[model samples]
Target: ILHSQISTIEKQATTATGCPLLVRCKNFQLLQLVIPQERDCHDVYISLLRLARPVKYEELYCFSFNPKLDREEREQGWMLIDLSEEYKRMGLPNNYWQLSDVNRDYRVCDSYPTQLYVPKSATAHIIVGSSKFRSRRRFPALSYYYKDNHASVCRSSQPLSGFSARCLEDEQMLQAIRKASPGSDFIYVVDTRPKVGVTTLVCVFAAPSHGMRDEAMLPDPLREPHLQGGFAQPCMAALLSCLLGPRSSWRA
Candidate 1:
């Protein structure tokens, strides 16, 4: 089966809402898993709405790993090309995209090293930053960061800052978030492990008219029941909430 853990989430104005002057941040965590791809991932599908119109989408972004390439492989030359013609010929979205390194050595963190397919429409932005985090007990994690007209998506080994102390209590972690995201309004939770109880931190750069959302702090008792001495489950919960909730606004 295909398992998913939302690590980060970001949103601002949508095509429906139009671009607004202010931005709000709501960081949360959530995830869902799908069955493993048997074969021909191109068969997987989804849809999108443009200008209140419906558009069918095929082509998917696959996430994977490369034990051969270390951290350095990610930086050099990455490109997000508009593969609309290629996708349309294959019955995919005209805006469908494929990530490529200028050299085309096959990206280290594209999808499942084996390849996990997701609809093209799911990618709201053309370019996405990618990374991988590996823990001893579980499978290596792959994360994708994207940026659109309003929302910016990012993933890190560290947490993002600026929601509220009630939601995220670590000061140092929050500082890291601020450094990574200076002007972003929201952070998207793309990958995370809840059972492991890893805490993620993110920050907000802009605020809407109402100020910010009041998120309920998770109880200390219910979180980090018996994991490591430093692990925090509440942060993972908050990460999921931001990712799976409405794409338009943040709740926490």
Candidate 2:
């Protein structure tokens, strides 16, 4: 069942532009940040720093893989380390590195889980491994990173029907939305593709029988002419709450 799901996700990813997925971890706090394909390494490194600042996490780890490459080629996964204070001192030297370096340049085994200690965090560790079950379990993470990470204006003023839907699959996001809506009519669309990544795209639409509400209710930023992409999870929740209704409460 899991393998089937992973296969479906890989197919969907083929259609979306690729992007690097950044994971920030400090003690028990873990946040995922998606760096659009258009952003350069420096931009991504800086973004990681910006994300960690508020939480006081001094460092973050970014990872990326190319599905198009063969097994041996794919084994050479990519990783980047962003140390906020270190970067500040050295003016942020290039921090991207190969995943093999975690194993002292040894080739990583795809079939078995590999544990690597994070240099920036003494107690933190990153597991680099892939399996039918592991990929299926964390499918949402795979899809979110593979898909083009961006936000766009709602092309159609109408409700969910014509408006562009954004994916919000992170568990943190779902909990926020569920807490806000509770027993409301809100519907969650979860992408269950077997791929390594999957995300829930929130769709907001009222029935046609109910007349459209005033457009003023939506936040001004969401109505702008350009599409805003690469928003972190908290921002995404706030945006969704605004679109849903005034009664929605966004958790910090």
Candidate 3:
């Protein structure tokens, strides 16, 4: 019966929106336990990792199970999982459970990392800069930073004095932007700086205007958020509104 169940899940993983499965080995016996589904594959993976607290596995494998791939590729689709590399690449918190821990005190804080798997047809633009306001002791500090572009990834820790960082001119960044249909989705990795804690990463999605250049009208990164540091959400919404205008649905 257990074997039948495992086979069933393995088959589902290749087609349905799948969840992570926990594997245990004891007395030379292996067990696969399916985790509950979450928002998406990424969320499911994170939840399962937290449940397996203080993970000590010597080897971890992630099966693609993508039906679009060839049969041979799907059959041999298992790949080693590297948590550290994934965290860095995805801009995820090093402490898998940190979001939940932080929420206890800062209940308003977002509980997930900022990431977006942009479709190939869409173009993405990134901007990194500091606020115009300065502290008594320090100059404008590094503010917003988020990277989840699977095709091309970039993260910056340095502060930008002005609009010094331009995604349109950067060759590496352009690689992620493609000529796609007008109104296609655009991903923006933004920074949300709270008054009392570290800056929070936020991912914003918008569609480009059909007539205008394939770019977003971003705010002057050198300036302050419209209302202190909580401008990330509004900024994203405004951009989408501007791009889509009144005719299109403003759903991100």
Best candidate per TM-score, number? 3
Evaluation by TM-score, superior candidate among 1 and 2: 1
- Among these predictions, the greatest lDDT belongs to 3
Q: Positional deviation of 150 in candidate 2, in angstroms?
A: 22
115 in model 1: Cα distance from truth in Å?
A: 8.7
Q: Report the C-alpha lDDT of model 2 over 132-204, residue by residue, as the tens digit.
A: 1122222111010000111111111122222322222222222322332323333233222322211112223
Candidate 3 lDDT over 1-252, as tens digits, reads: 222122212212522534555444323454554445545555645544443442422222232123677877765634465434554554544221111221223222222223322224222222111111111111111122233222222232222223333333232222223221123244333334453332221112111211111234333222223223456677656645534555365445
Off by over 4 Å in 3: 1-175, 181-189, 193-229, 247-252
Worst 10 residues of 1 by lDDT: 131-140
Model 1, position 27, has a per-residue lDDT of: 30
- Per-model C-alpha lDDT, please? 0.29, 0.28, 0.32
| Residue 16 lDDT (model 1) | 41
TM-score of each prediction: 0.20, 0.15, 0.21
Alpha-carbon RMSD of each model: 24.2, 23.3, 20.2
Q: Candidate 3: which pairs clash?
A: none
Residue 30 displacement in candidate 1 (angstroms): 50
Tens digit per residue, CA lDDT, model 1, 100-175: 2311232333223323222232231211221211211111122332222212222333222233323222222223
Clashes of 1: 35
